[model samples]
Target: MTSVQTEVVEDPKGLLNEDDHMRDMERLRMEIVAIRQPFDSVMRVTGRIEPVDPVTWTLPNVAVRIEVESPAGQRPVSRVYTIRRYDSALGEVEIDFVLHDDDSPAMRWLHAVQPGDDVWMTGPRPHFVPDHASGKQAAIFADETAIPAVFAILEAWPADATGTVWIEAGSLAAVDELPEVEGVEVHILQRAKDEAAGTTGRLFAAARSAVADVSGWTVWAAGERQEMRDLRNHFRAAGMARDDLKVLGYWKKGTSSSELDRMRLAEYARMRESGLSMDDMRDADIAV
Candidate 1:
C-alpha cells in the first residue's frame, strides 16, 4: 500500500496541489478525532473526514502521509502509512502505526496527540493489489511493522483464494491479536531473546523447514531490509519464479524512513537500469 507523493505541495492557505504530471494530488481535509491502540506498540488513528463527493478511491489500505513531530520540535514531519479503514458512510478513515522505537518520528508525534487533534493525510494512492488469480496460493511474510499491510491485503483477497502468512515479531505480546479470516493460514513466530532481528536464524529456518510445500505460492514479504531479501531469495531458490515474488524493505533496522526511501530509490534506479522491476526479477513459467 505504498504510494509516492513526491510532487505534492501545500500552499500558504493549507491547500494541496501537485505538478501537472501528478493529476491526482488534490487535497481533502480531515481531522484526528479518535485513536486506538489495540497493541502496546501499534497505534490506529481515525480521521473524521468530509465527503470527497466523487473521490471514492480513497478507501482502506491506501498509502497516506501522517503528520508527525521532529525531535527538536523545530519542524513537522510526515510518515507514510496504510489506511487501516476508510469508512465513506461514516466519513472517517483510520491509519495504523507500529512503533519500532520510542523516539521514532511517527511514534513520538502519536504519543503526544489527543482526541480532536489535527493530522493531515495525503495520498499518491495505493499501488499494491493482491494477485489472487496469479496462483493457487500466495505467501505473505511480515513483521509487526507490516501487519497493517498484510491484513489489509488479506482482507482484499478473493474469498476462494487460499494462502499462508508468517508474522515474526520480537515478542508474542507485541503482536497479540490478529483478525481471523478464511482461506489463509496464519503463523505467528516469536523471536527468542537472543535472536537478532531479520530472517537469519529461527524465523528463516522455520519458514524454510516448516513450509516444505512452496510450489504455487506468489510471495509478498515486507519487513527488516535484509530479511525481506533473504526470504525472497529462499523462495526463488526453491523453484519460485521472480515475477511472482514481491519484497519490500519497510525499514532498515537502524535507518530513518526518509533515509531508507532514498536508498530504496537509488536501488530502484540501478535495478531498472538492469531491467528489474523490483517486484519482477524472473518470470520463467511464473505469474506476474
Candidate 2:
C-alpha cells in the first residue's frame, strides 16, 4: 500500500490532455464530502475530485495512494486504497479503509480525517479484473482487506458471465454489501471476534476443496502476502495459465507496507537495469 511519488506537470490549458501518458499519474486533490462507518470493520470516505467523466474516470478496481502524516507528524506516508464506488455524475469517489487494531499511518489518518478536509492522492491506477471474456468460470478469493476491491469488481461484473466468490471476514454484514450478480455465488467464511485477521487458512482450504478442476476456472485472489503467494502457487501447479491466475498480496502479516515498498523498489531498480518494465515484476516472487 506504499508508493513512490512522481510529480506530473500539467499542460498549458491547466487540464491534463487525454492523450497524455501520465494523465492518470498526476496528483489529485480530493475534498472530503462525507465520512461514515458503514460497517464495524470499515471507514467509508466520500471525496470529490475535478474533471470527472464516466468514460475517463470510471474503471473497475481502480486504486489511489493517499498521502498521510506519520504518527509523530514528522514524515509523510502514503497508503493505497481501492475505490469502492465512483459516481461520475456527482464527481465523487468512495474509498473504504479497512479497520485494524494497529496505530498505522493509514489508521491514524482515518481517525483524524473529517468532512471538508482536502487530501492529495495519486492514481486511479486500474488493477486487474476477472477475465470474463475468457468464457471460463471466475473464482475469487478475498479477505476483509480485499472486500472493497471485491465490491468494485462485482459492481462492474458482466451480466452474462458466471463466477463464485469466497470471502473471509469477521462480520456477515460486510459480505452482504457486495453486489449479487445473477450468475455469481458468494460464500462467506466468518471469523470469530477474538480471532485476528489474516491468521486463518480457511480461504486457501476452501478454494482447494471447492475447485476440483482448475481447467474450468480463472482465479483472482488477494489478501495477506503469504496466503496470496500460496494461492498463486497452488493454481499454477495445477496447470492454470499464468495470465489466468491474477493474485496480488495487498498486505503482509507482521510487516508494514512501507517495508514491502522498500523491497519492491530495490527489485524494481534491478529490473530496470535489465531493461525490464513494470509488467515483468511479479509480486509473488518478492520473497517477503
Candidate 3:
C-alpha cells in the first residue's frame, strides 16, 4: 500500500552527488529489440541502448533498475535485474526474468513488454565478481534469480582459476544454458514443480555439505534473503573472513520488492540524518 503512494523524497543535502553517483546513475533509454522464452521458467529480453560506452556498459554482473507499474497500477515502481550478456559493439544487452506465479510489478512489465517498447532505467551498476585473483577456489551458490549473473560471470571467467557453482532451480533447461568453463564444475539442485522457489533449502544444504573447510575457498552466493543470510552466517562461523565471503539477498521469501525498496529508502534517510554515507548502509544489515 505504501508503495503506491506518490511522495517525492528530495535530497536537500546533496548526499547522492558525492562519489560516482553522477556517472553511475545516468538514465538511459532502452528500446526492446526482442523477447523470447528460452526456458519455461525464464523470459529473456534483449534491448538496445544508444551511444553505449564499451568501457562502462561492458562489465560482468552489472544490473539495471527498470521502471514498472505498481501492483495497484497507481505509481511507477522499479525492479533490479542482472544483465545476462552485453554486446557493446551492437549496443545490445540481454536480461533474463525468472518467471514466477506472483502478479508483481516485474511480471506485469514482462507480460506487457513488446519489441518496439521503450523503457527508462538507471544503471549498469557493477556487482561482486569472484576473487579468482586471490588464488583461492571460488564457491558459488545461486538460485534461478541469480542464474543470469552467473552466466555473465562465467563468460568472463579466467581459464587459470578453479571454482564450483551450485544452482538451485525448478527447471533443468535454465541450468543447462550456463557456459562450460574449463576449471569450474556446475552442479544443479533441481526443485520439484510444486515446490516454491525460496522455500527449498537445497542450496544452503548443498553448500554446507560440499564446503567443509572455508580456508581454501572464497564464497559468492545470492538468492532468497533468509537463505543467503544463513549462508553468510554459516561461512563466517566457519572462520571465513568478511572480505572472502560475498553473499547477497536478491529477494525475500514472502515480501514484495516494492516494500523492500520502501524500507531501504527509509533506512537510507535515517542514515543520512545521522551524518552517515551510503557506504555505511549495507543491504545485508537491513531488517526485512
Which candidate has the highest TM-score of all?
Answer: 3
Per-residue CA lDDT of candidate 2, range 1-288, in tens?
Answer: 333222111123422223232344656789999999997998989999984334545778888878765324223467789988888878899998889987677887889999999988877778899999889999999998889899989998988999999999998999998887899999999999889888898889988999889999999998988888888888888888998998999999988777786676667667756877576888778889
Total colliding residue pairs, candidate 2: 0
For every candidate in turn, the CA RMSD to the true structure comes to: 6.9, 5.4, 2.8
Candidate 1 residues lying further than 4 Å off, grouped into runs, are 1-26, 51-60, 70-76, 170-177, 192-203, 211-213, 264-288
TM-score of 1: 0.74
Worst 10 residues of 1 by lDDT: 1-10
- Model 2, position 270, has a per-residue lDDT of 73
For every model shown, what is its TM-score relative to the native structure?
0.74, 0.89, 0.91
lDDT, residue 201, model 2: 83
lDDT assessment of candidate 1? 0.62
* Colliding pairs, model 1: none
Between the candidate structures 1 and 3, which one is better when assessed by TM-score?
Answer: 3
Question: After superposing candidate 2, which stretches have Cα over 4 Å from the reference?
Answer: 1-23, 51-56, 70-75
Candidate structures ordered by TM-score, highest first:
3, 2, 1
Give the range where candidate 2 is weakest over 10 consecutive residues by summed lDDT.
Answer: 2-11
Q: Which candidate leads the pack in lDDT?
A: 3
Candidate 2 global lDDT: 0.81
